[model samples]
Target: MKINWKLKLGSRKFWALIAGVATSILAAGGAGDDTTLKVTGIIGAVGSCVVYMLAEAYTDAGNSGGSESKDSAAE
Candidate 1:
């Protein structure tokens, strides 16, 4: 089955998993709380934008035709 990029990108669970893993890795490397928090926040912020762009591209291709912004009620 094809992954729903939009849903995955917006998923709190997905983001939480990413944060957890990053925190674990940083902690294992003996990073301080401040560094870990800052890195995690930056990752989440940049990741949000990147995932959104990728998902739009993916779902647009999935529709296979016109570039209608169907999900956006205002559009």
Candidate 2:
């Protein structure tokens, strides 16, 4: 099967699902509230960064004729 990594990585729902699963697993393993919260926060922060970077890259590519963004051009 083919996967769209760029789109998938930029999705909030995808990241939230990951955080939810991680939180559930952590809680099941007896992790403390603070630890779980930290993990969740990190995940959210990283997810936001990923989305921002993808957006910026796509925007730059669109604005610059995909000169430096061959990876995001057409595929």
Candidate 3:
């Protein structure tokens, strides 16, 4: 049976999402007093890595496609 995740999560996920957003606000405001800077730094690092990997993959695919076209043209 396929369960509807949105219906199952409902308000629980909604509240949790809200709390997460609020926590981010506090961290951005520099009010954590504990792990604010560390949390933000970790998030930034992970985001940057994800973007870098995606860009590299796309560029490699494009390069491979161009090489194939050049080979076909020369044949």
Q: Which is the leading candidate under lDDT?
A: 2
- Candidate 2 Cα deviation (angstroms), residue 14: 0.9
Instruction: Indicate whether candidate 1 or candidate 2 has the larger lDDT.
Output: 2
- Estimate, for each residue in 1-75, the C-alpha lDDT of model 2 and write its tens digit: 999999999999999999999999999999999999999999999999999999999998787885647757746
TM-score of each: 0.54, 0.83, 0.60
Comparison by lDDT, 2 against 3, better one: 2
Of 1 and 3, the candidate ahead on TM-score is: 3
Best by TM-score: 2
Please report, in order, the local distance difference test score of every candidate based on alpha carbons: 0.81, 0.93, 0.64
Candidate 2 regions exceeding 4 Å error are 66-75
Worst 10 residues of 2 by lDDT: 66-75
Error of 2 at 37 (Å): 0.4
Using lDDT, rank the candidates from best to worst: 2, 1, 3
User: Clashing pairs in model 2?
Assistant: none
